[model samples]
Every structure is written in structure tokens, then in C-alpha cells.
Target: MATRPLTGTKVFLILVAFFGVVIGVNVTMMKLAIATLPGTDVDSPYAAGLAYDREISAAQDQASRKWQVNAHIERRADGNAVLQVEARDASGQPLTGLKFAGRLERPTDKRADLAVGLAEAGIGIYRGNAASVAPGQWDLVIEGDAKGERVFLSRNRVILN
Candidate 1:
């Protein structure tokens, strides 16, 4: 059987089909990536940058208070998560009688975010519990206040293992 090959039409058709498939795949991937974006932390980057000085001043204000805050997580066997928080002063004295609260924020998905609070456990120590938190990375944003004003703020990343 003799075969005739290298026809112009065949070559053109094959090249067109190859490029078409490549374009289709690229479009699909691009759409998926855009659809699954984690999210934006700020609404306006330019505005946020412009306000950077204010943020710095606020942080400096907090630092001036000389309050030290430490926080961590403990994952239990029953799939529950516990958040432990402790606060003190520069002189190592416990900062008691302050309000403390936090949130379990999913790194990528807001749907899985959880609000957790740390009630007073001991002198300067606070604890809170979440019934069931998915095992993964979680950002813990904690705030402490005294006399209805913010005193300390901290953001820590922890893994639920």
C-alpha cells in the first residue's frame, strides 16, 4: 500500500487544531484561577498605603502601653480547637480585667472562618473553644481592650494538627 503525505491542507488543519486546543485549555485554566481567588484584604491598595502612617501611629500607641500578648492553639482529638491567650505587662505582671477575643480565619476561604472568644481562665490567661474546625492553617486575630478602648492587637498563624 503506497501512502501520499505532506499535503498543505492536512498540515494546515493539524496546526490549527493544535493551536485551538491550546487556546481552549488556557482559557479554561484562566477562568478557574480567577473564580477561585482567595480574596482581597483591602478594598483599595492606594488608599491603604496612604493611610500607612496612621496605622503605624496606632501600632506605636499600642506599643506605648507596654502590653505583651501571647496566643496559641491546641487541637483536640475530638476535632475541637482550643485557643489559649495570655497577656502581661513589660514588668511581667499579668494584665487582668481586660477583654479578649479572637477569630479563626481560613487562609483562603471566608466561608470557613469562625468567631472564637477567650474568656478569663486565670490571672491574665484566657481560653476559648470551637466545636469543630477544619484541620489546616488558620489566622488568629486577637484583640484586647480595657475600659472600652483597644489596648492590644495581634495576628498569629497556626496549624490545626
Candidate 2:
């Protein structure tokens, strides 16, 4: 049997083919990473910085109010989530006439966030339902507004079975 002689052209072609495969794989991986990126948490970092003082002031106001708010989240057998909030003043009196809203946020993906519209169930009790909540970790954010102004805000991490 006669073996073909190793030539410069063969060596060059081998090198080119090896580098081409590496480059192709790298490009494919880069494109996949970019396509799957979840993006920034905030749209404008400068705007968020500008609002920092306002957020601090709001936090102070909320602290001064000394409101007692309790939130409950329950997963039903139908794979829905039920949220209930009970709010009270510092004096232990039920707070009334406030609009409450709830949100179930997925920590890893912002696109999976779910908004829940809560209605006043009683004097200080607010209830809302979210359909088809998947079993996983979630950030539950509950906000209370009075006369078009936000008065209470809370965020808690929860896990559903």
C-alpha cells in the first residue's frame, strides 16, 4: 500500500478546517447567548438614580404611617393563586377605602410577571386571584393606594408547591 505524501497544501487545508469549525461554534454560541438574554432590570439607570431621593422620602413616609399590613397567598388545587391582604392603622383600626394591587414576579424572567387586581372584600380586607401560577419561587409585591396616592408597599419572596 502506498501512502500519499504530506504536502503544504494538505497541512494548510487541515489548519483552515480546524479553525473554521472553532470559529463557527463560537459564533453560534454567542448568538444563542444574545438571543436568550433577559436584558437589564431597569430601563434607564440615570432615571432610577434621579428617583432615589424620592424613593427614600416615600420610604420615610411609609415608615411614619406605622401601618400593619398582612398578606396571605394560597395556591389552589386548580393551579391558581389567591392573595389576601389585611391592613390596619397604628391604632389597630382597620384601614378602609384603599385600592390594593398585587403582583407575582418571576425572579429569573421578567416576562413571566403576573398582575393581580385586588378588590375590597371587606373593610380592610382585599382579595385577588391569579390564574395558572406555576409552582416555583416568586416575588409577591403588594401595594396599597389611598385617594390615588400610594401609601403602602410590600415585597415578599414565596415558594409554591
Candidate 3:
């Protein structure tokens, strides 16, 4: 059998092919990563930082109020979730005339968050429903507003089967 020597052209082609595959794979991976990435938690980090003091004061006020808030969530068979909230004062009297809202937030994906508008079902009792709630881990955020001011805020982690 006759043997041919390794030529400069062959070496150049081999090097180009090797680096081409590596670069191609890297570009594909980068595109996939950017496409799948969920954006920042807050739209403006600077603004959020500026509001840190207000959040702290609000939390202190909520604590001082010593309000009693209870939340119940039930996932129905039809992929909908029912949320019920009951608010009471420290003395156990029902709290009235307050607007309540709830959110089911996906910890990993902000786009999957579901907002629920709660209406007064009875004294101190509020009820809301969210459609097509996927069964998984979630952050349940409940907020209460009085006279257009945020008076209560709570976030609890929950899992649904």
C-alpha cells in the first residue's frame, strides 16, 4: 500500500473543522440559555433598594397592628385553585371594609404567576379563584389594603399535590 504524507491543506482543514464544531456548539448553547432565562426579580434594583426603608416600616406597622390573618388554598380537580382568607383584629373581631388580593407565584418563573382578586364572602371572610393552576411548589402572597393603603402583606411557601 502506498502512504501519502500529511499535507498542510489537510492540517488546516482539520483545525478549521474542529474549531468550527466547538464554536457552533457554544453559540447554540448560549442561544438556548438566553431564551430560557427568566428576567430579574425586580424591574429596577435601584428603586427597590430605595423602597427598602418603606418596606421595613410597613412590616413594622403590620406587626404592631397584631392582626390575625388566615389563608386557605384548595386545588380543585379541574385545575383551578380556590383561595379563602379571613382577617381579624388582635381582639378576634372580624375585620371589614378591607380589600384583599392573592397571588400564586412560581418560584422559578415569574411569568407563571397568577393573580386572584378576592371579594368579601362574609364578615372578615374573602374568597377568590384562579384558573389553570399547575400543581407544584408556589409562593402564596396575600395582601390587604385599607383606604387605598397597603396595611398587610404576607408571603408563604406552599406545595400542592
Candidate 4:
């Protein structure tokens, strides 16, 4: 048999040493790159990006807790938009005799008050006609004062169409 130049054990050791050197060199290069970068909010730019991401997440969480009244837009067959207001107490119980101020805002930047013909048929529903409103996305803001406190409900972004 021909003499083997390198034993299997020797080949395995050489491969392990080569990989170890490669890994060490790669780690050193990464450290050097990090050291050369500017020292701002964090040593690495990725850490700064993570900090911004956390701030955005916190803001979103805060926004979700906002106590805004919930309502829906109803469109009429005559192409006019109708604004419906629902009055509720702090405990979410429907309240009657709630004097509300409803405003319907159209896409043309025109606004009209829908509080004139408001009728309360049930415990907490107030209905009014907004004939000036068109069949598109609209903004409905309703305000009311009951008991001893003033309540403000703004459905800032609503779709009428």
C-alpha cells in the first residue's frame, strides 16, 4: 500500500484549527466595525433602531387605550349620509335624554350640524339627518354633557360610503 501523507486524525485536527481561526477573525472584524461607528444612543446602529421600535410600540399601546365613542355610518338611498349617535354612561349603560351635539364632516371640507332633528327613540340612540353629507368617508364628532361631567366623543375617521 502507498504511504498515506496525512492520517485521518491529523486531517480532522487541521480542519478544526482552520475553522477556529476563521471564527476568531470574523469576531474580531465585527468588534472593530462596531468600535469605528459613531457612539450615539447605542454602540451599534442596530441597537438604536431597536430603541426607536420600542418607542413606536409604546405609543401604539397608549393609543389603544383612548376612550373614544364607537359609532357607525349609515348611508341613505337618496345619496345623503346619515349620522347616528349612541349615548352611554361610564358603565356602558344606555342613557336617555342625552343632549348631544353631532357634526357631520364631508370630504369637501364642509361641515354641518346634525343636532337639529335629533330624536331619542330608545334608551341611548340619537338619530339625525345629514342631508348635506355625500356618500363617502366622513367625520362624525358627537359631544354631550350628562349628570355632572361633559363627555366628548370623536369618531375622527369614519367611512360613510
Candidate closest to the true structure, highest lDDT? 3
**Model 1 error, position 149 (Å):** 2.7
Candidates sorted by lDDT, descending order? 3, 2, 1, 4
lDDT tens per residue, model 3, 45-155? 999999999999999999999999999999998999999999999999999999999999999999899999999999999999999999999999999999999999999
Estimate, for each residue in 1-161, the C-alpha lDDT of model 4 and write its tens digit.
89878889999999999999999999999999887654443368887787898657755653564533456567777866555667665567777766666676543434233432556766788776767555566667666655654444454767766
lDDT of 2 by residue, 1-161 (tens): 99999999999999999999999999999999999898999999999999999889988999999999999999888999999999999999999899999999999999889999999999989999999999999999999998899888899999987
Local distance difference test, candidate 4: 0.64
TM per candidate comes to 0.80, 0.93, 0.95, 0.46
lDDT-better candidate, 1 vs 2: 2
Q: Write the number of the candidate with greater TM-score, choosing between 1 and 4.
A: 1
| Top of the candidates by TM-score | 3
* Model 4 weakest 10-residue run by lDDT: 107-116
Cα shift from native, residue 95, model 1 (Å): 3.0
lDDT of 1 by residue, 56-121 (tens): 887899989787788878889998889889898989999889999889888788868898878999
lDDT-best of 2 and 4: 2
The alpha-carbon lDDT assigned to residue 69 of candidate 2 equals 96
Query: Alpha carbon lDDT of residue 158, candidate 1?
Result: 85
| lDDT per model vs. reference | 0.88, 0.94, 0.97, 0.64
